[model samples]
Target: MSQRNYRAAIVGTGAIAHAHAQALLGSGRAELVAVADVDARRAAEFAGKYGGPSTHAGLDDLLREEQVDVVHLCTPPQLHAPLAIACLEAGVTALVEKPPTLSLAEFDAVIEAERRSTAHVATVLQHRFGAGALRLRRLQEAGELGRPLLATCNTQWYRDEAYYAVPWRGTWESEGGGPTMGHGIHQFDLLFSVLGPWREVTAVAARQARPVDTEDVSLALVTFENGAVATIVNSVVSPRQTSQLRFDYERATVEVEHLYGYTDDDWTVTPAPGQEGVSELWAEGRTTTSSGHDGWLAAVFDALDRGEAPPVTAEDTRRTMEFIAALYASAFTGERVQAGQIAADSPFARRMDGTGAPWEKVRNP
Candidate 1:
């Protein structure tokens, strides 16, 4: 098939939008044709800085006027579904940011919209595309790591009261859940990508620091279907910020440690006992920096050109979202939540905090 340059656009001119713009421009597989934001000035300013892309005050105008092949939805969590649906309905593929939607219910709606449209929706879970992560996955799939036994995913970052000054920063209705949904989600998504589907989750959530309606910290014990258990900690109260994931397989232990993003150097492989040769095998393939949006976008464009479903498809993202729902459900109900337990009617599925925001009643410590 002849390669065609894909035309792209970005919606929502927020902080993350810049990353999207950079990745789209750098990917070379696609051209950023336009950018849209509710704030006309912000849109115009972003366009001025990004170069070449036109600007629109609203997505309606951009979708109606531009012939865009893909759109990066960089808006707040609450706006992801509606905006993504709009793009998909307009026959444009959508690549949404993390916490893809405020809740699983909202995500389901996005999936239904996708079924009726020619275009597809893919969530941004960039960590899965990193070179180290990809290598780890290959080793695991090849049975070189043996059967996975244990894992840990920690997203410990600091977000002060000032950081929540943004209207949607720490709210159940807007930003979705706190660190579990927003920050740690990247690490956990990568964890799930490597470990596979989770079977159950038991969790606890708290408003440990920030005076936000959502919990600033959460901890969960997840049991994967493969019988491997993982301890997950999501927190915005830690003074030292880091994104870490460690998987202990039968033959070797693979670990990645970095803040925000990672590179080849961030990954380490330690063999168990007499299994020293595993280290050499782990380094056998291509070595590249940690994958980011650019790496994922390159793959997305390749899939588009081939008329294939893009990476991080809704079905793929649903596992991560389902885990988020199960975490919140288990935390709020004080019960172990099983996968597929959060039906459409479940309060946690409908909203992150269940029936009501817990922090609303408790005084911030």
Candidate 2:
């Protein structure tokens, strides 16, 4: 691919949408063509701030009006898959937000849509682009971590009732799940992206919110296909903190101790004195790519520029969504959800729409 300026549009103008706009604008690779949101004011605000193109009512209007070559879907989880598919159908490449869709079925829809269209498709897993993420994968693949054994991810964030006051939030209908889907998903995305797939999940969810039906606290045990076990603890009850993940392997234990984002010193691969030196040797011998643009859209731009696939692909995201779906099923049924067996309309399917935990506990704290 020859070097050329790319035109792009962002589909959401909410809190996270700003990052998309900024990343696209600053990357010196793609231009901020347009942004759309249901709230016209929000869309207009983003349009004014980011420059270029224009805003429209919703995704349909935006897609119909803009001659955009790339579409960045930063909408809520439920809208990601459909909008992505819509973009692909329009012959436009797409980069969707995290927790790609409400279920694996929807993700499969995105995949099929990708197959149906010539557009490049990707899941927005920007966390996988971080410097730590880049270096860690190199070590793991080179056997620096040996055979990974266990890992833990803790994502605890605090949000007041006012935060959930947004109509779509705290409801299973709009935002997908609660903390596990909204907040904690970032850390775990990095987890599954690096550690690979899981075989089973045992989870427990609690309603600690003010008056929402979605879970506020959740804990789960994950068994990876590679014979590794991991634990996940996600909550909205603690003080504001950064997302973190710790990986334990046969040769080393690596950790990202910072939340929001981290680059230097946030990750470490430990060794038994001199045993894992082989990994160090391998790392020194090769230099790949690592970047701070942790969103899928910017990474997609780079991939297009290089004629390569994005680091986080649709199948990669499906694995995490697969884990999440199974976790919810496991929580509701109080049983172990065997991987590959948890499918749509399974016996353990929880009432997916505003019917989980408690709205009360989620509201106050």
Q: Native-vs-model 1 lDDT?
A: 0.89
* Candidate 1, run of 10 with poorest lDDT: 356-365
lDDT of 2 by residue, 1-365 (tens): 56668888888888777877778887787877778889998888778877746989887897888888788788877788778888989988888777677666777788889889878677666777776676778778877668888899999877778888888788766777788888888888888878887888999888776455678888999988888898999988777776778887777677777766676556655665657774464345333333345344566776778866565777777777777778887777677988787655653333333123434445656
Which one is best on TM-score? 1
lDDT value, residue 113 of candidate 1: 94
> Each model's TM-score?
0.97, 0.88
Can you write out model 1's per-residue Cα lDDT over 70-155, one digit (the tens) per residue? 89999888889999999889988999999899998899999999999999999998999888988898988988989999999999
Q: lDDT scores for all predictions?
A: 0.89, 0.75
Cα error, residue 60 of model 2, in Å, equals 2.3
Best candidate (score: lDDT):
1
